[model samples]
Target: MPTITTADGTEIYYQDHGQGRPVVLSHGWPLCSDAWEHELKVLADHGYRAIAHDRRGHGRSTRTSAGHDMDTYAADLATLVEALDLTDLAVVGHSTGGGEVVRYAARHGAGRVTKVVTAGAVPPVMLQSPANPEGTPIEAFDGIRAGVLADRSQFYQDLAVPFFGANREGSTVSQGQRDDFWRQGMLAGLQAAYDCVKVFSETDFTEDLKALDVPILIAHGDDDQIVPIAAAAYRAIDLVRLGTLRVYPGAPHGIVGAYQEAFLADVLEFLAD
Candidate 1:
């Protein structure tokens, strides 16, 4: 497996496919690069160099006990970009990956970036506070931490229901899809997976979003149960200087796979702009 060694010596695993302008993918929590497999194939076929990496402590990457926070996550991604010398890039992130992209663009600067896309992303903020009334309560995140510690396997199984909208009436989400979620969750490092709940839920990206100057596509499902649209994508777009919104009605949190065709089309169109 191909990998890059971060400044901290953490080995980050990655996949590179096709050949053209680069499109780097950042995946969500408790999941790895495999989550973006279909998107990569489609992107490569559409004439773009599609790449993805397993965030440190997830998938094939080193399962280090430290640096599970957002700052380090963005730095690791920055290392990947510099190592590959990718330029005029389009960075696409999903869920937790979305927040990473926001921080990356803000912290490292977008001098080499051309465009950005986030799907069902957690940003602006996810934790309830005086500034964010629409956000979820801290007790809810505490419940997630408990779930991770008490029964990760069962927790992942149950999370897949809402993550992919498998529980919704007339939903076409397959048993395999839910099983896939569990499989991915099981592959992640326990420490990293547990620590990520706080990273995604509590980290405020208001300043980061405001710092991005490149065009951004903020896509969110109206019915996303994990990260509500009102608090995440809705507020995120407002914070970014140049942001566009794509509302997926009746879509779940996993809109990328649930609405693959539409999502891909929207992404390609935005990239071509």
Candidate 2:
């Protein structure tokens, strides 16, 4: 397994495959690069290099007790990109990883990044501070933190319904899909998952979005139950000058997988432009 050592000496594991224009994927919270397995095959078949990393404390990466915040997460990705010496790379981030991509692009500039796509990303801020009156309440995140700390296995199992919009009246959720999600969530370290609640829910990406000049594609499910589309997706689209928002009607937060064909098609078209 290929790995890169962060400046702090943390060994982060990653997967680099295919040979063409590089397309890096950053996964959502409580999940790892395995979340991109479906998308990776699509990208590879279309003649693009597909790479994904198990975020620190998730999947096969080190289960560190500290540095679980967004800053460190962004830095870890930057280190991977530098180690690979990649350019003209298209970064696709989902949920918490979406926050990492925006922050990394802003912090490092557009010289190395060709384009970016954020799906169900929590950004422009998620916590409802005085400055961000429309953000989600801290109590909501607190609930998540407490759940993970108490009984992570059950917590993750319960999370699947809402995360995938299975609770909705017309929603269809297979037992296999739910099982896969639970398996991935359980694979991650409990400490990292707990700490990351703050990283994804509290970090402010306002400055990052304001500074981004590269072409960006913002896709979100209008009916997302995990991270409300109105607060996260809509706000992000408004912040970026060159950002294009593609709303998937009645789709859940896991729209990339739930609506794989359409989502992949849009991404391929966007990359072609």
TM-score on alpha carbons, each prediction = 0.98, 0.97
Runs in model 2 with CA error above 4 Å? 256-258
Residue pairs of candidate 2 with colliding backbone atoms: none
Best by TM-score: 1
Candidate 2 lDDT for residue 181: 84
Say which candidate scores most in lDDT.
Answer: 1
The CA lDDT at 123 in model 1 is 94
Clashing pairs counted in every model: 0, 0
Q: How large is the C-alpha RMSD of every model relative to the true structure? A: 0.9, 1.2
Give the Å error, residue 181, model 2.
Answer: 1.3
Q: Against the correct fold, how does model 2 do in TM-score?
A: 0.97
lDDT of 2 at 120: 89
lDDT of each: 0.91, 0.88
Residues 148-171 of candidate 1: C-alpha lDDT, one tens digit per residue: 999999999999999988778878
